[model samples]
Target chain A: MEFSLFNILDLLGTMAFAISGALAAMSRKLDLFGIFIIAFVTSIGGGTLRDVLIGNTPVNWMENTNYVYLIGVVTILTIIFRNKINYLKTSLFLFDTIGLGIFTITGVETGIQNDLDPIISIALGAMTGTFGGVIRDILCNEIPVLFRKEIYATASLTGALIFVLLDELQVNTDITYLVTALTVISIRLLVVKYKISLPFFTLDQKKSPN
Target chain B: MEFSLFNILDLLGTMAFAISGALAAMSRKLDLFGIFIIAFVTSIGGGTLRDVLIGNTPVNWMENTNYVYLIGVVTILTIIFRNKINYLKTSLFLFDTIGLGIFTITGVETGIQNDLDPIISIALGAMTGTFGGVIRDILCNEIPVLFRKEIYATASLTGALIFVLLDELQVNTDITYLVTALTVISIRLLVVKYKISLPFFTLDQKKSPN
Candidate 1:
């Protein structure tokens, strides 16, 4: 509301996530209504879920129509720019990473404000940063990328841990937020740049049908 | 909590939904943790979402551990009797329909108690009865059956509408709930038995790729 740096970052993140969602929906050949729905959910799903869990009534989007409007604009713009979207991939990825960082910190702060356990706070942070994309993937009928690929949630979790640790140490609030967000952004960028991934195992791999 | 008929029906619905979730997970060959997670979400996902939208915090499962224990037992039993599960399909279907009926009424009631608009209340009712299965299908990487198949949400919505209508007529509360639940259950059963389905269309079918 104050046009603060945090506010700007949050808007940017929301837009980036919306564009990503639009792209996914387009790939699936969803109709206009479906694309808007997907874009809206992908941008706000995590934050809405967090607010609901913490008993924040009406959820964030309902209380403030800015997010809804922003997502609407982004969805339309993405549709118009569909052909040139490939050229904007790098910038989109960067904005999405920034969103991941900021969302994770906000989620953690909300949890701490509610006096939730630190572990729960961390989970909230990671969920807030990642669950939107998870929902989007689910709606598109794909296994959530969170469960199968990327270091996405891990980055958010790491950032959340840093936030909790910094807050515990009574660090300056602005510095804590900056550091936490930077940490998440850096981790995600580096992981993708280097093709790094966590090890995965499937139990069904070794067992034959009974 | 009082072991009333509604309470019993609620528990049966929760258990039925949980088993359905567990069965879906096993079909995907997910690990035990994944199966439990799916089952847990499938049983409580709708009510939790409804509560969150209406600003009910700490959610239902957190308030009552009975639901948790019941789901746990259901999941274990489902796994143990996996090979024999086919024999129980009819029974499972019946319980699931009962759950659909009760959950719809409870959702509508919660919305009305919170002084929501009738339309919103009806939407809440349908969402509460159907979203758990929607979430389940998403987790299993399928388009929500509610969106693509069956008269699932339609039945819930119709039941919710009847509930609102009956309440307006100053019907007794118990009678209202009974009629609403039975209406939903009967509609679902009849729809399934008759192999009736809503017509669906995909936009891609008419338009060629650009």
Candidate 2:
């Protein structure tokens, strides 16, 4: 059933996101409580926002307490392997990208089920894929990388568009999901590998008046 | 009906929050687009989050576009009277506090209507009262004031608690709303007047091992 598939993917994404958040918190030298909070929000923030916006109350994680236990386990592991995890940046990146792919698909599909406009659906998908990290960076006292012309949101947006288009073309659901996720993961990897970015705007550099 | 009161308060709060957001953006020297975007988010971020969690979709601002116009107008006014407005800091603070009061009441009432737990309702109220500024601060690349042991969220929480308690005691709705809003506003003003702040902890100050 779709629920089982979503459950698996959601758990995987939560673990990956939790690890990323814990690392971020460690880097910032946050307290134990801060680390836990950051990890929880980073893992669930995007989906929480998406669910709220789509009128799904008591959100997914609120209904399923297991996600909390999973995040706790991930955070503890992250703390224990702090130094080792830092050295495994590439692995972390891959894990995070995988999460992004799965979350984007779920977000887009949820939007579709809610009968949202296609553009809004794609936006929801991109938001679900990226806003967790955005919240994470913000809590760490940094401008979100998403707003800094990073190729992050772009990758998710592209995947969401592809998924919508493929569905319109009568593609198989499984194949559509697979292709969309893979496309996002590939784009993310390529962007990072090539140092590719969107146009960078530094507003402070200009002296233009409003 | 409470609906009319909420509608008017909501509009006023939107304007105040929008102006505060515009001022923050201006202080950061963001471009016009950045100013507008920050203004929009700060005006609606908290309410949007609350509505989403309460299963309200398309969000209130999206459903009622007047909030957009109000923000746009507020942004333009802030830009045009930048220097003059900067000198009116006290007035701005009062306006922001008023918004916080009304938004808190609305948030708590919505939670009550949705049958959320009393504690959760209070939390939602505090979130509604403070999160617009939190999001604004984050977008401005600063640690949110809400997390910094300010007397901010505390004021909202106290008001929310009082509102819930009074409602449970079979208090008149009008008196409950007035008392709650006034309490929040009074606490905020007193806190500022007395330079009161909760104990602040900076994690980086510690050299504790993970």
Query: Which digits, one per residue and each the tens of the lDDT, describe model 1 over residues B57-123?
Result: 8566545667877888998888777766553445445655676788898789888989999999999
lDDT of 2 by residue, A126-168 (tens): 9998888888887787667676544788999999999999988
TM-score of each model, paired residue for residue: 0.59, 0.58
Model 1 lDDT, residue A187, Cα: 89
lDDT of 1 by residue, A33-115 (tens): 99999999889987887887877767777877899999999899999988876755565566567778888887888788777
Best by lDDT: 2
Q: Candidate 1 DockQ category?
A: incorrect
lDDT against the true structure, each candidate: 0.79, 0.80
Q: Which ten contiguous residues of candidate 2 chain A have the minimum total lDDT?
A: A83-92
